[model samples]
Target: MVDADWKPSMGFIYGELRKATQEIKGALNDNENAYKPILDVIKEKSSKRLDTCLHMAAYILNPYYYYYDPLAKLDVEADDSIVEILGVLFPGDYELQNQIKMVELPMYKNKLEKFDRPIAIKACAVNNEKFDPANWWDSYGGSAPNLKRIAIRILSLTTSSSGCEIIWSIFEGVSNFKS
Candidate 1:
């Protein structure tokens, strides 16, 4: 589970999941029979859980991938997903709709020019490792309020329930010890 107070961005979680899957596959090359089931389960569950509007929105909104990573491709589907999530999150905001029409729609339509200005320039100067993206969104809230809200909500989510399971395990251990 994600921490109540803090969490890694969805982009980071997605990257980690992809890397872990690749590593697992690589390590089980000859022992495919023993690990294939595990791999299949991981792939199935991850595809279902991670392929959501919120995750896509968080991934697109992360500046490290948005401006620095060549692998971050923003397609129409991603735009639609972000828009859908935003609409759900902010149903009554007319300014959000206008912003999408005037800024985001044009940016998506002209992908080549999406990173041409202020964002690209600023993103290049920042050290991604040290930078807290949540804080960045907080600062950019005035300039890109809708996107900032989307980023904050989506990025705060944990990709898996492993954290909760770990906590449960610890609780069980303590309960058994007490008993």
Candidate 2:
């Protein structure tokens, strides 16, 4: 995260975090009795430290995880509260939110309009490793303008405020020079 080029988008964070947790759990003791106790502790601690609406929203907005994660089923119902963040984002704009939820979201999820085009359909299948999901909105999401904006914003956001660290370092250098 300290390196801008290497910083993952906020949208990918929770899914990757989940994958990491799953890997650890799967690699632990085979006996459920033994591992269950440790797994519960791990879950408790990790959820307290890491779970947030931001993470859930990011996971939902990014199609790579939302539509096609191999590790786990994308449970939209489980992330309902995070989905409501979109409502809060526009604050009192029920019509727009309704359009997003009722119309735009479904189209994108179902791969209609430009999203159904050959180039877009091939995104997840052929060139998935090279295709950036954030850019998908810009290229093939014109029909769902509202979701396109939300997706891009969430998917493009850096996982950390590492730019602040650079500024802090510069300040420290200045302070040392003064001393």
User: In model 1, what lDDT does residue 35 have?
Assistant: 70
Best by TM-score: 2
For every model shown, the clashing-pair count is 0, 0
Candidate 2 residue 106 Cα shift, in angstroms, is: 1.1
Q: State every prediction's TM-score relative to the real structure.
A: 0.58, 0.71
How displaced is residue 28 in candidate 1, in Å?
10
Q: What is the lDDT of residue 146 in candidate 2?
A: 89
Assess candidate 1 and give its lDDT.
0.60
Q: Top lDDT: which candidate number?
A: 2
lDDT of each: 0.60, 0.68
lDDT of 1 at 91: 88
| Tens digits of lDDT, candidate 1, 16-110 | 55546667878887478867888788878777576567666665666655555544564456556767875786688868776865775445333
Model 1 scores worst on lDDT over the 10 consecutive residues at 108-117
